[model samples]
Each structure stands twice: as C-alpha cells, then as structure tokens.
Target: MLEILTGAGLTTSAGLNAFIPMFALGLLDRFTNLVNLPEAWAWFSSDVSLWVVGVLLVLEVVADKIPGVDAMNDAVQTVVRPAAGGITFASGIGTETTTVRDPDALFAGGAWVPIAIGAAIALVVHLAKAGTRVGANTVTVGTAAPVLSTAEDVSAAALTLTALFLPVLVAVLVVAVVVGLWLLARRFRARRTRGRAAAAPGGSEWTA
Candidate 1:
C-alpha cells in the first residue's frame, strides 16, 4: 500500500517534469541503498543513461522557460510525461528485488494496476499543467511563462523528493494544483468572454 502511494506520488511529479523523477530514482539507486530497481530498470541508473537523461533534463528545463516554446513543449510532453509516469510507477513498485518464483513479485507477476494508476494520475496532472500554461500564455502574453515554468520545475523536484518519503503529501499537493489550474482556466475564459462582449459592435455603452 505504501509502495503504491509512493509510486503514485512519483507519477504525479512526473506529470510536471517527465524526466526528473526517473533521474532522481536512477541517482538514488546508483549511489544509495535506499532503492533497488529491477534488473530491467537497472539501465536508468547506468552512467550512460544518467548522463543522457541529465542532458535532456537540462534541455527540457531551458525549453520550458521560454513562452511560445513552452506551449509547444507541453504539447510534445503530453505524451512523454504520462508514459514516463507509467514507467516510473512500475519501476518503483517492482523494486522489491524478488525472484520470479516469489508470489509477491509485482513485476515478475505482471502487475498492471500500478502502471495504469500512475499513467492516469500523470495524464490528469499533465492536463492541468498544460492547461495552466496555455491559460498563462493567453492572459499574460508570455510574460509569466518563465516564472510559471520555474515554479513548475521546482514543484516537480520537490514533489519527487517528497514522494520518496511522504507520498500522501504529494497526493494532496497534486489535488491542490489541479484545482488551482481549473480555477485559473475558468477565470481566463470569463475574462476572454468579457473582452469579446465589450468589443462587439453593439457592446458599447449608450448615452442619452
């Protein structure tokens, strides 16, 4: 149960930043005894894989800070992030270091539940993040994109770290972020409606 929560937490973090949680997991698996990734997932901790993902992570951070580019990046990540979430969740859940003969072996027994849950959680959060970015682009004219992107990166990192220990907190934070984005979307739509109404030919105020 706790393992499932922890994996879910990491999946939520992945929705915000696709590679960070995986990178973090890889780093942890390599340097510390805190985690033991399955043999299939051991590549995530390899030097080459780490270096490659690290470079991509750097690129992702940079690209996400740019306004127009960030939206495009979000569109690309709409697929990648959720997929990463599934992989991360599956790897995390399957890290028990058990044999195929073990009845409790999650990976060996083909546990799809965590993978599906993780992907679902990630997709929802990804939608929230992408929607919020689109809303910011619409309302702020790209001025807020860098700041928001930075905030998202920080949030993803924080959530990734927290998921290793306090997954329940990650769940709460994900919910809060989703709700916040939904509210922002509503506000953005309302403002756009008002603006359009005021611009219409008959929308102008009349004088006696």
Candidate 2:
C-alpha cells in the first residue's frame, strides 16, 4: 500500500500525490484524536501560502548554490516538515466522519497509532532530506558556504494547505519529487565523494 502510494505514477500525479501524505496524516489524526500545534500552523499560518510554498520548493532545488542558507534551511525544515506532516494528517482526519460510531469516541479510540505513523514517516523523510542537503553543501561549497535554506519553508506551508483544501494530487507529486531529489542527490554525492577520495594521495592502498 505504501509502495503503491509513493510510486512514480502516484507521485507524478499533481492532485493525488501532493495530498497523499496529508491524507495519511489525516487518517492517523482521526484515529488518535491528537492535536498537534505545529501542524496547525502549517495549515493556518497566513504568512505561508501556497504560492510561497511553491517558490520555496523551487529555491530548495538550488540550495547548494547558496551555501550557509542550505544548512539553515535543513535545520529549520527538520522541525517544520514533521509538524507539517502531522498537521496535514490531523487536518485530513478532521475532515472525515465515522458514520457508524460516535465521532468523539472514534477519535479517542484509534487515532494515535496512525498519527504516530504519519509523524514517524514525516520525520524520516525530513531527516533524509536534511542529510542530503548537508552533503550537497559540503560537496559543492565546502562546509562554510552560506545558502538560504528557507526554500522549502514556503512549500511546506503551501503544500499543507493544498493537502487540506485543494486536490491531493498536487501534494503527492511534490512529495514524490522531494523524495526523488533527495535520493538522486545522495547517490550523486556518494559517487563524487568516492571519486575524489580515490584520486587523493595513497588512494590506491584503500580497499573498498
């Protein structure tokens, strides 16, 4: 089920892809009845809109080009992504009703597990991207470069709302690209690091 949701076709679909994570988050929230504040902000913060989110996402793609900003962005995103995920999940859950059961009871009875799962997934994805950005910065600009990392900040806000109100397709596509980029960047960084190390002094002596 997870594989099917995150696959290329689903991820590429603008409406479904963007909202998948949110839907998952929502389902979890529904089962748990937990109120996550950060997620709330992602959805309600007027400062961070869909347009802003989209712009930030675009900026993140070239974050390595800036340096310090990239690292900062990673740090900020670390906290923001999971919260946003949780909020999206919770919000999504809040939208639906359990027809046969008392809504309050249902919320209290089985929401946390899904919410926790959503949060965990969001955290894992967030950390992976953070790690990737760090690597990209290290490779392209060394450790001291300063790049604006707030690129995704906007996207998070926008995506959160889109997941909440617009078609889920957009959310899924964005998430897919975000995940895909992270994977590609990691592989590229690994290859480059290996090539660089192999070319260094006494390089041949080190066995793989």
lDDT leader:
1
- Cα displacement (angstroms), candidate 2, residue 71, comes to 1.9
Give a tens-digit lDDT track for model 1, residues 3-112: 66567778888998999999998998898876677787899999998999899899899999998999889999989899889988887666542211121354445667
Off by over 4 Å in 1: 96-108, 202-208
CA deviation > 4 Å runs, candidate 2: 1-66, 96-108, 142-175, 202-208
lDDT for each candidate structure: 0.78, 0.45
Compared with the true structure, the alpha-carbon lDDT of candidate 2 equals 0.45
Give per-model TM-scores: 0.85, 0.49
TM-score of 1: 0.85
lDDT of 2 by residue, 85-127 (tens): 5544443444422221111222446656545544555666666
Q: Number of the top candidate by TM-score? A: 1
